[model samples]
Target: MLIDLHVHSDNSPCSCMSVAEILAEARSMGLDGVCVTDHDSLAVLAQIEEGFQPDGLLLLVGMEYSTPQGDYLVYGDVRSLPSGMDAYGLFSAIKERDCAVVAAHPFRAWRPSDIACVTCENVAAIEVRNGRNSLRDDRLAEKHAAINGLPRVAGSDAHCIHELGCFPTRFTVPVTSSSDLVRALKNGQCEPGEAFPLAVGL
Candidate 1:
């Protein structure tokens, strides 16, 4: 299944796309699913869970946690994450939960310590192809993932409508829920993939 693992809706202060617009774009682009990872928020996810299901496209709720080290794409049980916790704290907190964490855009102004965290087993994957990242940054992230033997995932890192399907994570099996996605990531059954043809110029 093709899923964009990182995306922001209007719930994110930096994103201009509404939840409805994101769903429409994802469906039109032929994506099987999308992870709505708004920065440090889950209000939109709660809204969706309440009764906003879109036919044919699975919506997974996640959060882009801003730690002192860097951002992490956290899937499953975000309720335990405390505000401003560092990467180490995050690793320890989710170690016992059925969750997966991916280092988001690792080369985006990353420090040496931050790069080291990508190798941690606790971090299930790395964002090798971020739609908003430069080619150099993406290459560096890809190399880091290879060197660390971590699974690679891609995401639009989208903050607007046009960026919706620019990059996606290809899953070997169908994942209908957050827990399923986390398990797939943890088991290394996914990888980064190209952007949709329609999204090439964006």
Candidate 2:
């Protein structure tokens, strides 16, 4: 019933959560699935996805990009972006692959001008609630999503277990292949539910 579109684990430099801890916390929080979005790396995805079938917790694989435009949550294709690629540059490179690219905390920096070069071709949604941002920032995110005519998404962007589901997003998607989840989100069939805002680096 609930799917967190943004999350991070020990694989990220800023996080320290183990895969087991993620699963347990997801269960405790009553989450149906969580996307493991690590910063600038996809190696952890291979390891995390390897054991998800047994754990019974659906895991979506994704990575974050520190673009000149700011942060982006990316899914679907991983081979296109190498580390150090600028955000706008990464969007161009991954466009052909049709990756799910969402503007992560778009208004968090108060400068959409930086990422103005980010085209809509690869962008899927705008993150409305990032666990690492304040309520004011979250509200700004909602406004950006509406202005862009993109679906609003939410996530803990959790680097820790307790951070799980703090701002979890719920997809109207049925339990199926991970691709179905992506499709559901793209078609505006999903929405963010509970939101617990945080003030990070502000």
Identify the leading candidate in terms of lDDT. 1
Assess every candidate by TM-score. 0.93, 0.84
What is the TM-score of candidate 2? 0.84
Q: How many backbone clashes does candidate 1 have?
A: 0
Clashes of each: 0, 2
Predict model 2's lDDT versus the native. Answer: 0.70
Tens-digit lDDT track of model 2 for 94-197:
66664667778766654332436433554777777877777898787777677767787887878887788777777776845556666776687778876534
- Give the TM-score comparing model 1 with the true structure, all chains together: 0.93
For model 1, which pairs clash? Answer: none
Q: Against the unseen true structure, what C-alpha lDDT does each candidate score? A: 0.83, 0.70
lDDT (tens digit, per residue) of candidate 1 on 55-91: 7888878899888787888998876677788888989
Q: Tell me the deviation in Å of residue 174 in model 1.
A: 1.6
Clashes of 2: 2
